[model samples]
Target: MKKLLIVSLGIIGVILVLSPWILILFGRNQLHDHDIPQQEQLVDDREKHLILAIFPHPDDEVTVSGTLMKLKEEGHEIQMVCLTRGEKGKSSGIEDEVELAKLRTVEMKNAAELIGADHLHLLDYPDSGLEKVGLDSLKKIVGELIAEVDPDVLISYDSKVGLYGHPDHRLTGRAVEEVFLEKRGMDGFTPQEMFQVTLCKKQIKIALKLSSSFQKNYPEDPKQGLPRPDFSINTRKFFPRTLQVMQAHQTQQEVLKDLMPFHDKVPTWIYSRIFDREYFREVK
Candidate 1:
């Protein structure tokens, strides 16, 4: 009886250690079984096209890095405007806000370079506090960027969905939308396409189930509508570059530490299951 008890405890320990690996293998196999088709239609008239992506924080850009890489490869000039330097973001070690902001700025620049972005506009809004910014102020800043870049394509968060319901994200989305709407009919200000960075409801549900970190950060709220993706880019080909872009944000390592085990050990197939596609909603 004593030996049996010892064996049971040993088995539990082994299972605890191996469970994450098991889940990753299972996920990879499932992805292999259910293959999704890649989008092959290229952009029309690609000569000297410009794209601008606006997001609330430095790391927020990772969500769309795959799509950005694809656009870059297709020869469209890309730029990113990060509203804040992420001064209020969590740091791996103890650091003051000013120091953290400078670190995140460098990290964001490295990430933008990896994605082949032509320019990175870093705004001075307070991190995690964008909601406090007045609407006029928000509009003025984004409007100036739009005028300067005159982007052919614009990408931003969805105000309605507000990925993870972050206040900064919501505010950024609203501001972008307001500016885009206000400038749509003006000469040389209208973008050919406007896309909201988003995940499919199905993917979001799966992520919520699989990632405890995601759950902690974004508590499920039925009040918020789940965005239905009107467009999707199969990012399987750009997944490695996306991972590299993410890795460039070294200061935010703790933010992704939970997934590193799978990221480091699992086959790229795991990423195919997790981040194979970048989804968006077209804002007409």
Candidate 2:
């Protein structure tokens, strides 16, 4: 029994020391298996660009926070647009919707600031009820903001998958695409590129197989595969700041726990080794 215990302890110690490297290998393998595209060559970092993000809720920005921080470091302006305050969900244990709204707004502002966002535009739309707002109405509201920002690049959730198949995410993505494609280069809205936040299909499959927490939780999506990412921004240097941006939304811990299960349990280096890059697909 003593010899068996000693051997088990040695094995555990080896795993503890090698886990980070193993995770890095796994991450690289996933990146390779998915055939993730390289960074776009035409994107000139020397020329300043206004990058705007549109999403349905406060914490949705988490998907792109690392990239935003990196861009800000590269002398680009970052703007975030949130369609709702995320008051409808009581995941925060706050029963009062009004109070929840107030808190979520503050959290979002702090998160945006931490992510180096220059502006955060808030639309007071009903949380979790975006479809009721009417597609045309949403297009008008989002169009007005696009005209005002005149962003060089616009980013939002993947229209086909919606980053776990959220209705609000899908709707906001649809609105942004329709509004921009219909009126580009006509009404002072000259955003040249549209990028959608996404995980490559292989990555999604791997994540789903590894974590039972996400099983049976996604809404039905007609799209057969997850959206493929065309660009990957290496945020390896800014992952610490990314954690801070994530923690800024304290009230949304429940939601984050599933997405980042090891964030708190593992050291930053280990966590960053696996999630060191943010993925996006540019709409052609």
Candidate 3:
């Protein structure tokens, strides 16, 4: 029995060691799984006045890609800031923190370009490890970007748990809120005073309720739900493009496989897609 136990343990250990590569090998399809010839929309304007997105990881950007793509196609000056390189993230299969960061940075840039936004900001902070970063450093880094972009509309994770409540996400919410309210009138700031920023509390709740309802009807599927959302953006038009952008994260194929189906099942006409909301206030 002891020998059998030993063999079992050895096999488990081998699986653990090889799991990352196996996931990567089989998951490579995720990277190239995009439907060819992205859908295009005919819109009136193609220049953004100013739109900015702040998120903790690469995929977070897609939470509101439909609105963003529309804005971009309409010619809104768009910019995105990814706080971390997602180095701590398990994707890309590279264990070296430095290399992983570099890889994700490239991946993010590629994703941003696909979205028609060339200005992508990478803070290069430690990934999934914001709890270890200096608060002062974080505030400053985020503040500088806010000042530079001075975006008319800002989107980010709800400081609350509307978007998975990751610590890094929370930090993004906190930092952006802090900077948006306090960094006004600072040098290099191009203020967009009338801009409306969107957040995801209500939509998350709606997604949750809807997900619960679906799960109840179809218990065979794993239960997943988001919180209710106040607003819903129809992203079906942008799914192909967004899917391509999200696929750039090479390591997040499984996540896509799991979530995309749910997202697709959502009604295209009334998908409860909500983003968190925090707007800038001029400094006193």
TM-score of each: 0.81, 0.87, 0.62
Q: How many backbone clashes does candidate 2 have?
A: 0
Name the regions of candidate 1 deviating beyond 4 angstroms.
1-38, 45-48, 210-223, 257-261
Per-residue lDDT over 1-284 for candidate 1, one digit per residue giving the tens place of the 0 to 100 score: 99999999999999988876787667544433233334542245346678899998888888888888888888888899999999887756736889889999999999999999999999888988777787688888888889888888889998775676677887788888877877787887857778887665555666576666557666456556546666677777888887888788888877764433357665665555555677777777
Q: By TM-score, who's the top model here?
A: 2
lDDT of each: 0.76, 0.81, 0.57
Instruction: Give the Cα-based TM-score of candidate 3 against the true structure.
Output: 0.62
- Summarize candidate 2's per-residue lDDT along 135-193 as a digit string, tens digits: 89988988889878889998998666577767788788889888777877775777988
Better candidate number, 1 or 3, judged by lDDT: 1
Q: Alpha-carbon error at 6 in model 1, in Å? A: 37
Badly placed stretches (over 4 Å) of model 2 are 1-19, 27-34, 40-42, 209-222
Please give the distance, in angstroms, between residue 261's alpha carbon in candidate 3 and its true position after superposition.
3.5
For model 1, where is the 10-residue window of minimal lDDT? Answer: 29-38
At residue 109, candidate 1 shows an lDDT of 93
Model 2 lowest lDDT segment of ten: 213-222
Q: If ranked by TM-score, best first, what sequence of candidates would result?
A: 2, 1, 3
Look at candidate 1 and tell me the lDDT of residue 120: 96
Which of the two candidates, 2 or 3, achieves a greater lDDT against the reference? 2
